[model samples]
Target: MSINWDLYNKRLNLHGSTQRDRLTKEFKIAKESKASSNPSCKTVKVNGIDKQVFIVAKSDKTKFSISPVNSSDTLQMGDKIFWKNADWLITELSLDDDVYVSGTIQQCNYTLPFQLNTSDIIQEPCIISDNQTTVGQDQNKIITVPDTLKHILIQYNSNTVQLQKGKRIFIDKQVENPSVYEVTKIDRITHMVGEHGLLELTCEEGQVTEKDRSDLLIADYVSVLPTPPVSDLCEITYSGFPEIKVGTSKTFTAVFKDESGNVLTDVMPIWNVIVPNGYESYVSFSEDGMKLIVTVASEFDLIGQTITIKLSNVDNPDGITLDVKVVSLF
Candidate 1:
């Protein structure tokens, strides 16, 4: 018999899924939970200004309670949350097992200003904080930006998101010679069917040395972002469960790569699962079709059964087929 989860949701005063609508904040979250998500998010204004999230939880000094926020996004890492009159950065993303997308948030100190497609600097509302070490590294910080401007600080990758990772720009163009910062790192925050739009960036203050002065130009306020190199698909790597567990679905994934081991994110891979004539199996695929899942009813389906799955790409007719076996965990 299925356990009545509503009994537990009520004991917690969640009132079922209605808890997300009750005493929750409205956030501009992503529309998709997979790759190819949108990043160029336009802010939503309430009462002539952008919306802000306020936490009433007394859980800790900085940690917010597990209250739900209204948004279409998957609530993943690299997504910023405005809190405590300051913008706090989300270091961990929520999982499917989570009771609301709960995680830790540190205050942001700065914003990685952007000029989408060489336009004027799009002053991002919230802060992103400065980095000390490696580019695109995830670290824990107690940092924060002013809370008056509350919003999530989402960053997009320089590749599929159409921006340059190393592009340089001025925080303010009005100043005679404003400070320059270069985007040294980027992380994709939005998810449509796939990862897309506003990326998290790790920018370091840039210097204008005399040797570099001649290279500066008036027409080009910022360096043009470079497009990712088009590489031929060289190999495919398959990752899957060694054996199918009882009463559990197993997932298998394929990673397309080039000769240099760089992931080829542009390809569309398809999966095919086959079982023996007497066996019954249910199959599924991840949102981006990069993963395949297989599940059988019980030992009845396992009797005299052998399972196999193959990966292929329709676009790349030359792509090789990978055959992997799936045996019963029992």
Candidate 2:
């Protein structure tokens, strides 16, 4: 047997009133409860702005209250609410589990700035994620111009529903010499309960006018490359091995070679090492992800223990392993 909950909605309208102006209004709140399942919305003052809050508790399946606002406000994606005086950001919205809502606790109410090209041709608002410039390491010479890549986020607007990949957008608010960008990636957010959607876009930073400030442009353009074929019977080659003595330091550059002697640089091999007790710092990888450094302390008690190393590739799960001796005196 199903239960029916009769809910009541009270709307208060104040007119020229003091704190103790009780029961002197021409309009009184309706005092009858009605059975309804349709979601309702109301605007509340939050941070000096009127924010729409939703209530969907009539059809709640959880039996218990998942959100404190469920009794008064309908739940929606990206809804902001306060609990115990702390602000919470609504990350997910669902009604399957009794009108569930989930999100992270925001330390404070914050607003993001918009960087958009405000022209009559395109008036939709968009924001840049971050901007960055490359260090001269790739060029190996004196760089004249800085290379940049921009990560852009464009919110889904009900007015313009035709936005897709490869669409060009403006970066600045100026129409005189607008900075344009071609969208590359579109990250879509979907929910099983609500119809709200958010789009995360990636763009290649385009030409900017010399008159504009350089600091306005941000993001790094990383080239997406194809992966190489998986290798069989891969071999792990490194330097300075056979016996790692205590109190000594050695560096090893490990590279995986295929059956045809071709180095598999695209296939990232997982490194797995096992060291005995007290020699935990015997092996480590370099910051550049190319070389491995091994430093064993002389005070290690387990002298004859074996150190095993395994390098694995995704396509070839059965990886190769190498064994080394742990020596105390040389």
Per-model tally of clashing residue pairs: 25, 13
Candidate 1 per-residue C-alpha lDDT over 136-219 given as tens digits, one digit per residue, 9 for 90 to 100:
423665444432111234544342256556666444344456556566665553422135234555556666443222223222
The parts of candidate 2 lying over 4 Å away from their true place are 1-72, 78-127, 131-147, 173-178, 189-194, 208-330
TM-score between candidate 2 and the true structure: 0.29
Q: How high is each candidate's TM-score?
A: 0.32, 0.29
Identify the runs in model 1 with alpha carbons over 4 angstroms from their true place: 1-66, 69-89, 96-98, 126-153, 157-160, 171-177, 187-200, 208-330
Total clashing pairs in model 1: 25
Q: Against the true structure, whose lDDT is highest?
A: 2
Least accurate 10 contiguous residues by lDDT in model 1: 26-35
Lowest summed lDDT window (length 10), candidate 2: 26-35
